[model samples]
Each structure stands twice: as C-alpha cells, then as structure tokens.
Target: MKYSKATDYALHTMLFLVAATPNKPIGVQQLADRQNVSPTYLSKILTKLVKAGMVESASGANGGYRLKRNWENISFLDIIHAVEGTASLFDCSFDHGSECPIQQVVLSAEAKMEEHLRNQTMFDLAKKNKNKIVW
Candidate 1:
C-alpha cells in the first residue's frame, strides 16, 4: 500500500533523528535543511511523532526535537502507524455486507506485511544501508 506524504516525511524524519547523536535535540530548520524538506511541513510531521511518543520536543533557542526511544527500539511500522493508522495492503469492501470470497487471502497478506514490518527496525535499516548498494 502507498503511504501518504506525511508518512513519508515522518519516516525520513525518524531516520534522520536516529542518525544524529542520541538524546541530542536537533532543530526543525536544521533538519529540514539537511533533508531538503520544508521546515513547516517537517514541523507538522514532528508534531505527530511527538504525540505518538516516538519523539520529544523542547522549546527555546537551544530547543528542538529528539527521539524518545532508541533507533533499535523503533520500527518502520511504528513510524507509519504514528502518521497513518494501519499499514494494511488493501481494504476489501463487499457489497450488501457480504464477505468477499478471497477475504482470507487478503487478510493473510496483510498479516505477513505486518510481521515483516515488525521484524525490521530503524537501526536495522541504517546498518543495512551502510553495508552497500548492489546494482
């Protein structure tokens, strides 16, 4: 399933935060500039993350945002859930309240997707990317 732009930004924001010094808050403007994203849009995404308890925010000149949990403790699914509700591949709606014949197959795929997401974490992503890129 395709995620909204907000979810996309939130994922990047999380990755960027994890790459920074742990427990150190990074300003929105600084982060936006580094990621080449609009500070205003990034701020909205950060607010949602803070609300999800995935991020913490501080106000003032030296204030900014930081990850509330370690990268290893945070998963890609967590970021998606924080921004978008569920990561279901597809939502099947049947006519007249009748269940679809292939409901079980759809549900199975959704479960597998969730399991995959749960198995991966931000730290895993960072390490995997740092390893190499094969053409």
Candidate 2:
C-alpha cells in the first residue's frame, strides 16, 4: 500500500501550488526548498505532472510552474497515477488467474482507497486550509 517518495512530493507540491498561488508560477528551486528536496529531482516529478496536465511550465524570467486551468477538478488519484502509474498495487505472484481469492481481496481494498482519493481534490484541500501556510 506504500507509494513512492515522488508521489508524496507531487501531492505536496500540488497542494502548495493550489494553496499558495493557484494562478501564479512558482520556481522549481523555491518548490524544492520548501520540501528540502533537490530541484533536479523535483523537476522530474514536475515533468510527470506536466504530462498529466495537472500543471504547466513557463519559460524565461518569472517563469516556472503553475496549476493548470482544470486543477480544481484534479483528484488525489490523478496525482498518484501521474507519478505511480495506474498499475494495480497488488499482483498475485501465483498464477491463480483473475479469480485468485487473495488478489480479489487486495484489489477490492485498493478500489475503495482509490475511490476515496478520487473524491478528494486539491481545491477542496486548499479551500479548507486557506488561512494556513501550505509550506
């Protein structure tokens, strides 16, 4: 059930973008500083987010990353999938086919978790914590 550090960073980065300045671009160095991570490493995560259409990048001075127009509709699941991919968390090693009882239980749990994540969006979180400093 564990997700990658990249996923964790991506989620936090999205939340920071939404809460701090949804419409304004934030530099990658600033974002990395906030998380105590390397800008180069964070850039890779941002690339995935860009490809997923969650965020867009700008070039030149005052250029960086900002939440996309449809960011309000982006769910947690979307961010997770962007970094982690859509593969099932648990794949039964035994060739018990799709009907494997253990696999079925794990998949069911994953579905419920995904459903919960899908219901929660960055906008919802940002709005809830509007008064607080995201970083």
The candidate that achieves the highest lDDT relative to the unseen native structure: 2
Stretches of candidate 1 off by over 4 Å are: 87-89, 95-99, 130-135
Q: After superposition, how far is residue 131 of candidate 1 from its true place, in Å?
A: 7.5
In model 1, residue pairs whose N, Cα or C atoms come closer than 3 Å (at least 3 residues apart or on different chains), thus clashing, are none
lDDT of 1 by residue, 61-120 (tens): 889998786556898888888888764566567662326657767787778887888788
The lDDT for every candidate, in the order shown, is: 0.78, 0.94
**Tens-digit lDDT string for candidate 2 (12-96):** 9999998888889999999999999999999999999999999999988999999988889999999999999999998788999
Off by over 4 Å in 2: none
Q: Hey, what RMSD does candidate 2 come out at?
A: 0.9
lDDT: worst 10-residue window of model 2 = 126-135
Q: Candidate 2 — number of clashing residue pairs?
A: 0
